[model samples]
Structure formats: structure tokens, C-alpha cells
Target: MKHLFLTLATITTLLLLLSTPPTTTAANAADNIVYDVIGEPLQAGQAYYMVPYDYSDVGGGGLTWLQKTKVTCAPYYVSQENVNTNFGQKIAFYPQTPGQTDITLSSILNIVFSSFTPPINCPGTSNVWSVAADPATRLNFIELRGSRGTRDLRTWFTIEDVDQGGYKISYCPRNRRVDCGSLGIVSRDFGRWLGVNGTNPLTFVFESEEFFLNKALGTKSYAA
Candidate 1:
């Protein structure tokens, strides 16, 4: 009788554990599993594409479906050979438009969103980003590095949560202790959502991390 009772209790415990859902993580938002490209988490100086994704899409290994052609921020120019070099390597983004006293992350996001499709529709652009993974904080950040003009530039970004392409991005605060508590983020590309003062960190999300498991580099649209 004692052995039977113990066996029943073990079975019940196992069943309950199997039914419980695992805690969601930053990378696993809504179970958005991006496997990686050729053992990804791309290294610094290694070129990759920064393409655009729809608000309802979490880009990943499912091929012949997700359109990989919408890269909004990158500009393309024809080479002398008459071939277009994918977004012309890495391009530098202006921190602020010329002669602007103040700017919001909303404006930047709107610009990128608009560029994703239409007048400024940029194609796949190959670029490199440097990783800044801190083991202590477990907060890994990346900075896009490429030649812009006479000087090379590095743009810092941190990705958090779901909404596919629409996630939260903010530069690490210089103060290091300034944390915006419960700062809610929305999904509209254009609006007066989150503003930035000189002191406050600019919060926005760009399609910084686009991945592919078995696909080739410079991958564009795929039709199912």
C-alpha cells in the first residue's frame, strides 16, 4: 500500500511539471525562436544583413515565407561593374538631423519604418556590429560599426521583448543607474510616443538582429 501511494504521487508530480510553461525570456519572447546563422550570434567585424520585418513577424529559420528584402535605413548605390552591393556595406546613422535642438526616438523609428517601404525603400545591406556582452549583468548589447564618412561610427542598441520588429531599444545610460521604471513601449512606427531629453536615454527598436539557420547570406524575400 505504501509503495503504491508513493508511485501515484510521483506520477502526479511529473504530470504537473510537464504541463507548466517555462518562463519567457528576452530572446524567447512569445516563443520567438531565432536559431541563428551558421552558429550565429555574429562576431564583430563579420558582415551580416540588417533587414526589416513586419510588426507581426518574428524572423527565423522558416524559409520561403518571410520577406527578407525590406531594409529601410541602408542606402544602395551602383558599383562601376553595374552590380549593386547590398546596401553598400555598413552605413552610419546621424545621431540627430542637422540643426535640430531636440529629437525623439519616435521620429527616428518613424524614419526607419517609413524607409522600410516606399520612397526610401532600402534593400539588404551587409554590415558589421560589435558585441558588448557583459557577463555580470547578463545584458548583451551590440553597436553597428562601419565607415560613414572620414570617420567610422558605432551605433549602440539593446533589444528586449516581443512585437517582432517592434521591440524596445535604448542606449546604455552614462549615469549607469538611471532605469526607466515600467516604461511602456507601443507598436506604431510614427507618433509622439517616447521623447528624449538630453538626460534621458533614447528608447526605440530597430531590426538590429535578423537571423537565418540554413539560409545563405544576403538572403532576400522568400515566397511560400
Candidate 2:
């Protein structure tokens, strides 16, 4: 009888240990805080792409060379139709290329949008934001506000896992109410990957609860 009781206790203890969540190290804890904010890690071996549209200079009229005249510029505006019609998907990264590397635990990819067709009307003009993948398992973070400018727009996205089949994504933004509003469109499909790499680039897709048009613009238009 005693032997049977001991055996049951041992099994219970083992099961409890196995069921517990893995303990996160200090570095991992910090990374979790970051990943909790962003969506997932941008892997090295994988490829990424983005397409941006600026309507600042879409409309313009100048005089001929013979007759130099100072002419007023026409007001340019970018509508949803213009974005959907004119902009074609652009690849931000191509893994098959020479320099492309599979995203590992310790890798960082930074993409900045500087020039605007009409100049980004956002509050801060000069600034740099980045998506950083640290040396942690399936973890990534994004720093929206950098040393360049300050206009209260900050957020992040993460790539949690990537393999032969597909990938997973997550989005967490600071000041959700305000930042979410400014992000525009692409924000809607945050935690989903339409398609990683296949026949068509424009087919890339994602799904999430907090969807925004600007976020979609960034993903579909910028990171197509």
C-alpha cells in the first residue's frame, strides 16, 4: 500500500513540473516586455517587404524653359482610391538575395520613412523608428520614437514564429486610443500573415481584432 502511494505522489510531482510554464530569464523577461508590445520577431532567413505612398508631389505645374514664371502649386490629396489604384506592392526584403539572412534570435531590422510626396503631415518630421529582434526565442520588439523627432506616435509589431509552412504576428501599441487612431489603415489585421512568399506578392495577408486602415496601408502598401 505504501509503495502504491509513493508511486502516485511521484507521478503527480512530475506532471506538475512538466505543466508549469518555462521560467523566463532576466534577458527573456525584458524581451517578453518588448515582445508583449510588438507582434513577433522578424526572422533572418525570411524575407520582408513594404510599400509607401506620399501624395505631397503628385500634383504640380511649372512654366516652360523659355518663359520662366513663378506658378502656384495645386493642392494634392491622397484618397483611399488613389492608394488602392496607383500603389503596387513593394518587397522590403528578399531572402533569396545575397545579403538576406534568416532572422535569428539576435538580429535587428530597421526601416525608416523619411521623404513624403507632400511631406508626412505627422507632427514630428525628422525621426527614426525600428523593429529589433533580440537573442531570444521567437521574440521581437519595435521602438517607434527614436532620437529624431517627437510627436507622441509610438507602437510596435512582432513576428513570433516562422518555418516551412508560415508565420505568426502580434501588434501592441502604446497609448492605444490615440496611437491607434493615427496609424491610419493597415492596423486591422495585426496578428495574421496573409502569405509569406509564394506566387503573388500582393497576396500577403493578416488578421487581428484592432484593425486600422493605416496599419493595412503600411503592411499591404509598405510591407507587401
Candidate 3:
């Protein structure tokens, strides 16, 4: 009788334990996963095509795609393309945290643009996204760098999900602590440029490299 009672109690406890769901702490719950266009989690070091959030919203007469172009035959500044082009669309994201393969919202990371191909030769040092040190421009213009880390506050950026729709990129380097600035378009030199300013931040989406290649090179749309 005693053995039977003990066994029954143990079974009850096991059933209760199995019925209870595992606890998810606030920290874990708050880590919102940023997904790609196809609803897959974005991974660091993987190439992605950064496309503007809404194609029709950007009323500028052309596609609002991010691309690289030199202003005065110098360092390539990130510029907006009115139409689609083969070059300057590929970019890779690097997380600030070590061993962090999955990119989460509000996490600090470095954006690096891929190198330019033939004919469009522009001798630049680095492709890591960084702000220009131009005192005249208030360091709003985005430029490329050879290397960047936690120590260099100018290199760190954060990805945030906009309330309206899509996501927006911000740069808030650590100066004692992290202070992010909104990234938006600043019109200059008869061109739309990306900079840290009061203008509306450009809402954008990440299209996986695979889809971009298929749509750009092949006939399949790969809509998702």
C-alpha cells in the first residue's frame, strides 16, 4: 500500500511538471527577432539586399534603393538610386556581440557594403559603414571605413522596427553610453543622400541575397 501511494504521488508530480510551460524571462521575451522579406531570421555575416520599405511611398520618380557613389571622385558616399542597378545593392551585417549569429532588433551592429566592380573604379580604403568626419556637414553623411569596433562610436548602428511599417536604421555610438541618432534622407547636390538628421528616417526592408539574385538575374519573382 505504501509503495503504491508513493508511486501515485510521483506520477502526479511528473504529470504536473509536464503540464506546466517553461518560463520565459522578460529579457528573452523582449528579444524581438528581425526577419527577412521571406520571414526568416536574419543572420550576421550573410549578404542581403537593403531595399526601401515601400516602393510607392518614396515619391521621387524612381526606385529608392541605397547605393554607393563618390561625390567628388573621393571616398564613396552612400547614395540613393532612382532606378535599379547591378552594383551597390549588396551589404553584410556584423553584430557587435561575439557569437551572436542571429540579428535581433535594437542590437548594435556594423553594416559593410560590398566592393565595387570593374569600370566604376573608385579608390577607397574601407567599405564598413561609418559617418564622414566632415565638420561642415555635422558628421551626418554616411561613409565607409576599413575597420570599426566598440571603441569607435561612429561605426556602431542599431536597427529598429518602425511603428508605421518596416524598419529604420539609426547610428548612436557609445559615448559613455549608447545614444542613437535617426538616419534619414538629406537632399544635396541634386541627389538624395542618407545622413543623420531630423528628416523622416528611411523605412527599409532586408531582402535575402538569394531572392535578389533570382529576381535580378533570373525570371522568377520569388515573392514572399
Against the true structure, whose lDDT is highest?
A: 3
The deviation in Å at residue 42 for candidate 1 is 8.1
Clashing pairs in 1: 169-204
| Candidate 3 lDDT score relative to the true structure | 0.68
For each candidate, give its TM-score against the true structure: 0.27, 0.25, 0.73
Q: Tens-digit lDDT track for model 1 on 1-224? A: 99999999999999999887777554254243221223223222222333322312322111011121246553321111112122212212333234432222322211121122223233333232222333554433232222222222122323343343333434443344433221222112221122112122222222223432223354744221
**Which ten residues in a row are the worst by lDDT in model 2?**
59-68
Cα-lDDT of candidate 1: 0.29
In Å, residue 44's CA in model 1 sits off its true spot by: 8.6
**Model 1: lowest-lDDT 10 consecutive positions:** 59-68
TM-score of 1: 0.27
lDDT of 1 at 211: 32
For residue 211, what is the lDDT in candidate 3?
Answer: 71
Residue-level error in angstroms, candidate 1, position 191: 24
